[model samples]
Target chain A: MLKELDPLLHSQLRLGVMSLLMSLESADFTFLKEKTNSTAGNLSVQIDKLSEAGYIEVIKSFRDKKPLTTCKITKKGIKAFEQYVEVLKQYIK
Target chain B: MNDEKNLTPQESLEVITSMIRQAKGNMKKSSFYFLLWGWTIVLANLCVFILIKFTTITNPFLVFGLTIPAAIISVVYGIRQGKQITAPTMLDNINRWQWTGFGFTCFIFAFFGQRIGWQINPVIITMCAAPTFLTGIMLRFKPLILGGIVFWVMGILSFLAPVSWQFLLASFAVTFGYLVPGYMLKKTEA
Candidate 1:
């Protein structure tokens, strides 16, 4: 069954970030930026949005003296992703 | 800063949302390696467990606890994985650990068993404790990390327990390591 998606998460870029997070246990901002080929500013903006949504968590900490920003999928984020995939699958058929 | 900025609050929010969605898509495309590789480690560990339980398993010392034999197997396994299980960032950290947790578990049990006899270490607890700890930090989950910490502390304290205490540690290891966390993984679906 196709389920409702929050309009906020349906955007092209934001959906990309959430989709990545939903599949992974965690990832860094740079990795996400590189994978998406997104500008740093744009990636930062997207991460902030996901963090704000409580769909994903942004953990800021230091490792080996470097400022580190890591992201992980929240339980809510997983549910949203499963629902998102189900909805998208409908279009494939 | 506010006066120079032209975007309305709602407009900015929408922009951010769209950007995140795109990033999520990219992430999905890149993570196939982790899912496949991580599952392999989990499966291999389960296989070893089954093999040991079913086989003659003459040497409990070699088969269970912190044994060098198990660590040897893990190091070879971990090294074989090489870059496929890269753990450069906190995100990759969990992936990096892979089967190394069991390696440590094998080492602790092996060393302890040799001199101290076939007793479980209370503080050492679960062989997977260290890996779980890394996962917690990488995932930014406090409870999971705390659970690892508790298991580790238990491992260290195992040495202090009387002869009977070894069994207690073994039981606790299963309870905290596989049972509790397994339940959580199922319930939370995380």
Candidate 2:
């Protein structure tokens, strides 16, 4: 029997954000927006959702007197992503 | 990028691969640090070689003082580049620490290698190989890996050569280990 996909990481934007975060040490809001080709409003909402799920950590700090939001994948997020990929591979096979 | 109800496994795999590729793409820009140090060290090595061979100067090592300016330039350039980066990736962290450690090793060698009566050339070249080799492995760049190997081999050989010829060997070592790979990195950026 096939396992269910990770609901938090199954959607388009959230998955993109998680995948990007997985590869990086930490990424800020602007970088994520640029890479995902996402608008700030939509990206903020998805980031919030992921943050709420405890799949990622969001840190807000000031850089050069400007606010910066940096996102990094949590350990929970890494486990989720790995399981998601394992299930994905099964379906692909 | 549009929101969808459910993504197929293939689409999910594609997303992961595509985003990873995009992240890696950001690292394509050349830092030019290698090129700067390559030329500076090459010049210093040759200057020392020439002074010892031709001039009546008692201290040929004075020419190495030129590296002060080189170090300043590297610091300024590094700060400028750091400001432009939006985020640090894993590879970036690794590369930064690798070079930092290498820099510390060089500093130690510069200050103590002479006091211990150790030949500085072989030690310098051998210590320099660590960062270059690690960087090549991380970036999957073959030229740098080979260059690192060249440095190691030449560094060992430097011990066997005559003292005067050791300077020439140092020159050759940096030319291949740094200059060649430095230019190759620039070419990849282009």
Candidate 3:
């Protein structure tokens, strides 16, 4: 079961985004981008994938008519991260 | 919390960023505490030497208690001058190393000091200081500062035990024990 999650989470940028978000309740797009070294277009696609999977909640709002995206990890995301670690441990073992 | 319901995504991002900057500032301030404690220790020892030379006073612990409050005030005041760190560095590791060194020094001081013309001071130095430094590093917290306070109070009480050179012990108690730990705390946080 954990094997299913291993590949999805191993992506570098998404991994960085998830790890950073794990430490925080939520994070802005800029923080996620800067930390993960991802371009805007690339991040948007990854975020959408994770959102579609129910792993993250994306909130959008406008300040001065500008769009912003904030990411938050969902319960499913936490479970995935935990299961991902458990599965990864087998590889090292 | 529901205030976000009406605002645009840009406003939400701005609000969260502002929160992050404020939290970052507080954490940065906590890290420089070790630098302040280290300087305070060095200065206190120097002051002790100066006091012993001029006054007929044999015990320096009283002066030590005075010096501590000063250290506290200075730590809070020194916030203005301390460097602000927003990123991680090897310096964070250095913080842990310093406290470990202080713990070892205290243990070594205690072992030897307990054997010979050993005054009560070295023992107090080991007891109060070694743990304080070690705890700060282990916990990586600033508010763990309460440990230093507890150590200081114990050092003062150790003097009333009818021990000779209790004054020497009390002063070293705060200097070697609590202060070293206090200093290491800021470094360990990164």
| Poorest lDDT segment (10 consecutive residues) of candidate 2 chain A | A3-12
Candidate 1 residue lDDT tens string, A1-93: 545546546655566666556555577877777655678887788778777888888888776578878888899887876676566556444
TM-score (C-alpha, index-matched) for candidate 1: 0.41
Query: Which pairs of residues collide in candidate 3?
Result: A61-B8, A61-B9, A61-B10, A62-B8, A62-B9, B34-B183, B121-B169, B129-B177, B133-B181
Instruction: Please list the residue runs of candidate 1 whose C-alpha ends up more than 4 Å from where it truly belongs after superposition.
Output: A1-4, B1-98, B112-190
Model 3 chain B weakest 10-residue run by lDDT: B1-10
**Candidate number with the higher lDDT (1 or 2):** 2
lDDT of 2 by residue, B1-190 (tens): 7556578888888889989888875553443988888888989989989998998999888888877888889889888887667867888887977786787778787778679674788788887887888788877888889989988999899888887778889889888988899898888877
How good is the docking of model 1, as DockQ? 0.05
Strongest candidate by lDDT:
2
- Candidate 1 chain B minimal-lDDT segment of 10 residues: B25-34
lDDT of 3 by residue, B98-142 (tens): 654654665465457546554545354435544454445445554
TM-scores, in order shown?
0.41, 0.89, 0.40
Ranking by lDDT: 2, 3, 1
User: A19-89 in candidate 2: lDDT tens per residue?
Assistant: 89988988989999999988899899999999999999999988888988999999999999999999888
